[model samples]
Target: MSFADHTIRVRVPGTSANCGPGFDAIGLACTVYNDLELTLKKEAGVKITISGEGAANIPCDGRNIVWRSVQYLLRKAGLLDQYPGAVIHMENNVPLSRGLGSSATAIVAGLKAANVLIGNRFNRRELLQFATDIEGHPDNVAPAIFGGFTVSTVTRGDVECFSFLPKFRMKLIVAVPDFPLSTRKARAVLPAQVPMADAVNNISRASMLVAALCKGNEKFLRNVFDDALHQPYRAKLIPGMYDVFAAARKAGALGANLSGAGPCLIAYALERRHCEEAVGEAMKAAFRQHDVEAKILIMDLDTRGAHIVK
Candidate 1:
């Protein structure tokens, strides 16, 4: 069997999941991106090159997450034997284990490349489900694939999701600490169950958070972020978590929360204030007061999601 050469490029955005009380259900896509270029050949081997964040820690061979995802999609589509060779070039700007959906980007990128090479056998919705299957959660994967703000749930092995553009103008100030906290460790610290009261609290708050965003009500947005579930337990591992959240709020942020798991806090600041840098510095100083150093990034909502380019 002979197949003509093909090249597919993909750009997937980084995501912040568990926004406030949404808890594995809601997510936001930011400007950070991980780019991949794949070229299919008639040969039967794979070559990958990765640079930028996670360059040292991420594998460049068969064990790489991107390659593994590519293989999974290709074999599932029954096209692996036909297109057995590929050259992959990746630029990973999202940091791993920092709660920035770096893994989500990789999975989405790989599946997209494989689907493109096979003549778009799977649509975006199917690809979103595939990415969510690989990630074990839809919050991050949904937004990484769909962009903007996404709320998703897993029901009977199916990923159901909806996404929308922000009704309000805002900027995100993400403060990343010097240390890394794996999602496994963060989840391990959480309890297997919560009280009924806590569950009810999160349910209401999560609903309001969505309404707040849709209605552009800053008051509800600010008040709706309180959670009684994961944040308190994970706080033990994240340095200056509460203090940093407070600092950002005092400096003109609408509200703040742990980006996804821990070690990075994303604050929603008003774009009109022009005080993002000051808020960032306050967050850094708060972490510094606790003997931890952190860096900051300012980004806007990425509404276009992931796409393929020539």
Candidate 2:
């Protein structure tokens, strides 16, 4: 096997899941991304190259998630024995274990690369199913594959995704703290059973959040963003969670919530200037109050989903 074989490159966007009340169901794609370049050869071997964030931590062998995703698809397509050799070059911009869907992006990129390498045997939906199967959830994977604001639900071993292009002007400000919280650890803190009141509260808020977004009712968001299901328990993990939320609100954000598990807060607003200023100031204040450093980023909703970048 040599490097000069059929090659394909894929760029997949990072995603923020949950989006306040829409726990484990809704997600939005952001501008952050991970790039994967895969080459296939006739021989039977696998090599992986990694760079950027988590390059030192992520495995550069068959154990990598990207490599596993490609192998999964190839095996499913009954072409596992056809190509014995592969070299995967991964450039990751999304942070790992930070709830930015870094793993999901890598999985999506690998599936896309495998599809191209195998002569496009599967379409986007099929690839999405493969990714979802590996990720065990469709929230992040759905938006990473379909883009924009995606509403996804998995039922009866099937994943359904619906996307809506945001008509109103908005900015997404993400505040990432210096500390990191593992999703597994965060999940462990949640109780196995919740009170009926908690369930009903989340349901109402989730519905209002969706309605506000679809109808572009910014005012509805102020109260609609409230979540009693996960945020209350998870907030204990992030020291600055409440302060960040308050800062975002005071700084002109329509609503703010924990991005994914914890440690990262997302503020939404219609004005770019307000979003930038408010997000920045809020992040700084929150970090200072918590005695932790932070980074603030402003990005718009990514309408274009996964596609070849040539």
lDDT of each: 0.88, 0.83
lDDT for predicted candidate 1 compared with the true structure: 0.88
List the pairs of residues colliding in candidate 1.
none
Q: Look at candidate 2 and tell me the lDDT of residue 293.
A: 80
lDDT of 2 at 108: 92
Task: Give the candidate number with the greatest lDDT.
Answer: 1
Our tally of clashes for model 2 stands at 4
In candidate 2, the residue pairs with backbone N, CA or C atoms under 3 Å apart (3 or more residues apart, or in different chains) clash, namely 43-84, 43-85, 44-84, 45-84
Worst 10 residues of 1 by lDDT: 1-10
In the range 1-310, model 1's lDDT, one tens digit per residue, is 3334777889999999998899999999999999999887668888888889988898888788888888788888887877777899999899889999998999999998888878888998899888888889898989998899999988899989999877877899999998999999999999988999999999999999898889887777777777889999999998789999899999988888998987689988878888889889999999999999999999999998889765
The TM-score measured for candidate 2 stands at 0.95
The residue-by-residue lDDT of candidate 2 on 172-283, one tens digit each, is: 8888888778889988989888899988988898888778788887678888777888899998888878888888878888878888886688888886445567567776
